[model samples]
Target chain A: MASVARKNLFEDIPRFLVAQAGIMFAVSLVTIQTGILNGFSRSTSALIDDSEVDIWVSAEEMVNLQLTLPIPAATVSEIHAMDGVEQAEAFISRTTTWRSPTGDIAPVQMIGFDPASRMFRMGQLTEGAIANLQEPYTVIPDRANLGALGLDEVGQSASINSLPVTITGFTRGTQSIASSAYVFASLRTANAYLNSGLTTTSNCQLEGDRLTCSNMFERDASDIALDPPRALRGSDGITFVMVKAQPGQDLNVLSRRIEAEFDGMVAHTQTELSTLTRNYWVGSTGIGFVLGLGAGVGVVVGVVIVSQILYASVVDHMKEFGTLKAMGASDWMIYRIIIEQALWMAILGYIPSIALCGGLGWWTFATQGITILITPGTAVVVLGITVGMCVVSALFAIQKVTHVDPAIVFKA
Target chain B: MVVSSLQSPVTYPIHSLPAPAASSSYPVEHQPRRAAIAADHLNMVFRSGGGSYPALSDVQLRVPSGIVQLLMGPSGSGKTTLLSILAGILTPTDGAVHLLGEDITQMSRRELARFRLENIGFIFQGFNLFPALTAAENVELALKTKGVSRRFARKEALDLLEQVGLADKAKQLPKNLSGGQKQRVAIARALASDPPLIMADEPTAALDSHSGHAVIDLLCRLAKERDRTVLMVTHDPRIIDVADRVLYLEDGKLTQTPQS
Candidate 1:
């Protein structure tokens, strides 16, 4: 049948375009808010999700991977002895101050891991970057943070906690998500830097606002024996124990055993640990709450404005609806026509909204050094919201339509 | 349009009716007049914030097939209200209306709508043409509502427009048409579904005298040729000469009744 409902809608082209614009405004607001929130979640849990470990043993009451407390390094040996454990490695993650060459200080998240362990998958590394980290006092910072660290090239010198160090090579995909730089160091270098506490006691002197180890500067970085700082470490501690399970091993069973074997320790399978980190960052911090609130407001405002548009459209052609009713059009058929209009608006409006969000995400990632990832999963969620919003608005407009008196056609 | 014989089968019960209404236009002298509309003991009361007000008082009317019956009354005489009840657009406060042998007042709103779609057509005073649709499309909407396919509805709408002497204006919108031309479109729309009965409420009230007479003449010619029963409510005396009978209302009461 030729759709009288559809003809009535297209009869007013300018008004229809205005309705589409309302739909566009609503969908875009939701997409942008949701995309930004997704970015925060992804950034907070990137490392936990990237690591292929079956279990992670963190400090007592460990809430998030963002700032893990120190657990005894000896706990690694205990975990390695557990059944179903294929391998275990010590990991250290901390947010510490990094002083740029020009004396500009900023926070950086430093991670120390064994190069041979498969428990972690360090993102794309430069050629020979891993082998080069074997030398003492060498650190590889992500290339994305080069401008912030005030280092223009590789081998550039920087200081962490007054301990002099040189940038060995650059890597990608390791940029710290929490508004800071990300740097990778070998266990040998991290133990020298992290376990040694705040100060370097070995011939460390401040020279023109730049900390330089007099003994460390004399030998080339390739010597590998010039760093006497590692001997100054007093205690052995690591923030996390990354555990890999044997093939066909049940991670739940292994995690339960690790928790049971050690006192004041928590064990989580890979997915559990990742979710824990994500939830902690999003819930414990006020930033995630603010972002979620913004998304909620967008949805509400979208609903109100879009419903008004739909309601106004219904009001505008109410006479035609009454005419249809008088001519024996069923309620369901009339409601179906209205729903089809909403569906059309939802699809047409959603495409441009997501495209706009994707563009905004790329622009911010490029210019502000902050990632706003609009992944396929995020797009799918936003699409659901957009379609649901329009349909709800359509149902709202139908309330007015249902009250139309078919006798009104006689009035004129 | 296929015209049905006035002698078609008497499928409905013949209600006792007033002689004048039953006598006006019986085409067949021997055969009983098929009743297109039979109403008994109708009373319409409209209630609002002020109070309850009676609009029609115990009105009984039986309109036979193939006749033009003009319902005449002063303002607020319930002429439109009675037509609305007979058309099943309004349910009487206390009465039963049987149109085409079916009791419309007893039917559900949905069933009434279905029955109206198949058996009745309407033309209103202001023409009531959908302003957004062209003349032919406005007529096509009626055919489509009757479950006619798009291609046939379009062709039938044009053919009906041609019958109303507005074939050249079929593509014009109502806003661009004259009062008589728009009325012709409304007439075409009423005839599109080929219904057995047509109802018009002051259909010529907005037109000038010449246009009003022309509109009513075109309507009566179509209704008589197709053997359709037409009940029109109007105050326009110029068009009353074309009616087979003119029923008058005064203060919501019928002034005359004669048994046939």
Candidate 2:
């Protein structure tokens, strides 16, 4: 071979430029990935945290939490009696407004539940203690109600439905869809205040091996001039029942069993509820869909950018390739130059892209309380995608240059 | 015009030339199978939108052992086309091109590309140096493309640059060089692989008279000093004196007289 010492910069400079482009593309992809994942995780977390039970058994007709159906209260007792089952509770949710301590009131969704159940008290406490919620004389206000109730701590009282009740505790993350205050008190307290005619009954009985019961509220009853001593459940109407599964018992199986026993009620597992909430938001309007679609578009743009950089570099160095071809360099040798450019770009772009995306993800999460779960697997996949884009682009660029006639160099 | 030694066309069939005549001069100590370059009745046709134009018609040539030959023609006289055919950049419409007695015309596009990379040296007009590469790097690229180890090819490229009197300009880009200097770098690139046949098209076309003469001098001297065969195409008459043999073409046919 003829001995000729050439410049070493040729090997490094083009590669560096290509890699810089790849980094920009990869960074954009990471941002999109982080944003979408954060939105999804936050929505799921909210849905799960608001539920009243660890496990919920609903009828098969209800896809998720879109609609609530009433199950006979006897089903709750049956679930509570099952082996390995810790506890079961019943609750009803309705949108309403109550009198604040300062007299100005806001719209709220009051959740009526048994305060004694540990599973129902998992919502984060902002002040005082849930123990103050021992009797009918008290109400636990959600965090959003704190300012208006003039309640800084326990022992402060607030009024609902013209009945004055003490502010036993304050809990965070209890907003029920659209920042509505979530007032948690006994079912009796809520039914009496709302005048919903709900009542409790002892008509619980067993039909065959399964327990069967009906709503306890009296029929054909007139509105009383005075408040009832305890809350009543209307015979025809009630909301949802929360069922806790026994240890080692499959929730799916229990859910199916409840469906068979009482086909009118809808049951859901915790994970199912979380997924349903995310799906609901994504399906409700065009904004969520558009954001997801925008992320997809970002990926395509990234690939094209990578491809164009490699192609341009190849076109610029046609003569160098022709010269090499005349030197008895194989086509593979020419191909390596182009491929190396892309590979280098992928490597350079990956670290900074991931770092940028990760930083952006944390910032979004902190400010909006969205959950962006950036796992190593996702990073690796994004890196692989960048590399793949580079390679495809390189292949095309190399194809064009390798065919350049060495005679053109001569003609020059 | 320079006259032919023979009164009538010599026209001796190429096959009648002793086989060893083509092989005897190459410095093949171990690998005697290496054939530098060969062509037989090579014909090239170009298809324009109007009709087909014949670039070469039954042109036959050979560089045996080590010899320097010149291809001279006016513009559009097909000198560049024939050179391109020999270097495997363009396939002859009819007839065969052999490199080291192997028929390159019969090779596939892929195989022909391999042949060009292994056996040809081309010097184009304007030197065609890569703008992004320094003088030394430009030559190293040739060796690197051929799968030569970096350490070995780097040393070799530097040596070839020194041979062309540009060892000091190895780090300079093409834009930084004078007309003659870039041509010299091109020459270094041509010799990077030490191929047996160098086909150069107007190597000194862009240079001043003095620089042009200097480039011709180096081309001739290098071919002779290294015992390598050279075929340079030019219309310039100044370097005709240095050519061991000169063939002229006019309107795609071999001509007996120079226009001047």
Candidate 3:
């Protein structure tokens, strides 16, 4: 009967198999592509690549790595001149609302950096160009943000903090998590609007294994003893310091040393801080759970579609099962027939699904500036899930077949 | 009905029947193991909805090896029910049915299936051939179920198909075969495993006279010449003359009639 089953399978190919193949193909595409996205998008940030870095300095106990920390300018200069140091620059980051010309307001990350810094040039722009840091009234936004801002070409004006800034050049990596627009501006301009024009020259500087502060930014500036405190105690300056270690330098060790030298400080590398930020977004903010919930919904949809197709096939061929049983074919033999049928369908479906998903993933990464990479292991997992779903659906038909008595073959 | 003669049956020795001095004959000894099927006071009950329904009761018969026994009755006369029991496809509610010396009523469901696979063959009224398989492939399925390898099973299936006069249509699907040809393929399938007993449920019902006679003749030849046992359930009088014995079933009771 096995031989007959094989021949029958070949003859039954076109009608039942085509439907099954279509469903499996869809499942393969969705699950595999989602898996690829989950695996490759490091830190799950909308705009970031996996790279090595050493230390990140933030305010003590600040959970938001990107948006926290208000270090004085004196500490920035002192960190650059510290032992085994390379360079130090002031950094400012905050989340602000962008009010479009159409009066539409959306949440955005306003990143403040030095015009002459390398961190500003770290990401590649997908559209327009990066902002000129030396320019006081210009900003660069992510391409997605460019669309939201209705700013297509250069010289388009958008309001950040109600301050009009020209869209000098569109840049990539502007999203924080899920297409939240990111804007880059000068630290000087950012601080001006932050405190009602009480702008002060920051006294933070780096020198000889220590980042010391003038303590002018503190409420009790007199009582606190600061190493290398400015001779002129009354000085105001930028509120944060961002230090970049030289290539091949250990910033984790340097960060530890800086914290020991200057108490009540936080320091981390770019990689550590990015991971920390992503964890904050996905874990505390509940966005990661939302994306995961979407993937689970995709799996449920795949199962329902695949099962319906298999059930219809089973209903069509019920008499054949009765005949086989009357001819002395056992229940296991019939089960093999159904499972083999489903197995073939799954294999056929997986081929086109993988291809379609690969194309979609490529297109998504290319157009969105999001990295989604599909690995061989992830492909295997998707194949297993597809076939597993097929088998689960086939089990219903098999149960029906087993319950069929040979007597039915002759009765009708 | 000569029931008394059967009850007081006498045993015979070799050479009891007159034979020419020039003719030779094989022994016709009843080996007791020669009882291919025996049912003593069998009963079958089906329960459904609110109550139990009796499908068969007090059925008793014995069919010896190397003879064709025909079971005849009207529709719902328990002919199929009896056939189901004798073929080990269903268990009797009471009494015992022994096929080749093993009481099938006591066998487990799995055991009964294995016994049926190894010892019994069935030909359904519709021929019940898998529509997608060719004639030879259908026969091959029977042999394959008996654990024959694909290579040897195909060769044997081809030989069986040729014996049933279907070698020319070996590769044709059931949809393309005539009613008679399809039944011939079914017969070939029933004979594939060389089982000791063959049961046919109206095997010749759908065939024309010529085809019907050919089918009965093939079954008779296999019985008398090959020592195979055959039991056919049918209401066709045309086949009654070919049987070594006949049993009539009415309301699930068996009545034996001996030929003069």
In terms of TM-score, which candidate is strongest?
Answer: 1
**lDDT tens digits, residue span B1-260, model 1:** 12233222222223433343332222222225767887877889999998999998877777777778788888778888888888888889997788888888989989988988888888888677777789998999888778888999999999999999999998897889999999999999888778999999899889999999889889988998888999999877677678876677767776432111
Model 3: per-residue Cα lDDT over B170-224, one tens digit each: 9999999988888889889888878888889988888888888788787666555
* DockQ of predictions, in order shown: 0.39, 0.36, 0.34
Pairwise lDDT winner, candidates 1 and 3:
1
Model 1 iRMSD vs. native: 2.2
Candidate 3: stretches off by over 4 Å: A1-48, A73-92, A96-107, A112-123, A127-139, A155-168, A177-179, A185-262, A267-275, A284-309, A360-379, B1-33, B49-52, B215-226, B258-260
Reference interface contacts recovered per candidate:
0.42, 0.59, 0.39
| Global local distance difference test of model 2 | 0.65
Q: Top model by lDDT, which number?
A: 1
Model 2 agreement with the true structure over B101-154: per-residue lDDT tens digits: 788778887787677666666677768777767888878877776567888888
> How would you encode candidate 1's per-residue C-alpha lDDT over A273-370 as one tens digit per residue?
77887777778777677877787777777778678877887887777777777767677767986888777778877898888878888887766646
Against the true structure, candidate 2 reaches a TM-score of: 0.72
Report clashes for each candidate as comma-separated counts.
Answer: 1, 40, 34
Quick one: ranking by lDDT, best first?
Answer: 1, 3, 2
What lDDT does the true structure give each of the candidates? 0.77, 0.65, 0.67
Q: Which ten residues in a row have the lowest lDDT in candidate 3 chain A?
A: A225-234
In DockQ terms, which candidate is top?
1
| Residue A311 miss distance in model 2 (angstroms) | 4.0
Q: What is the TM-score of each candidate against the true structure?
A: 0.81, 0.72, 0.76
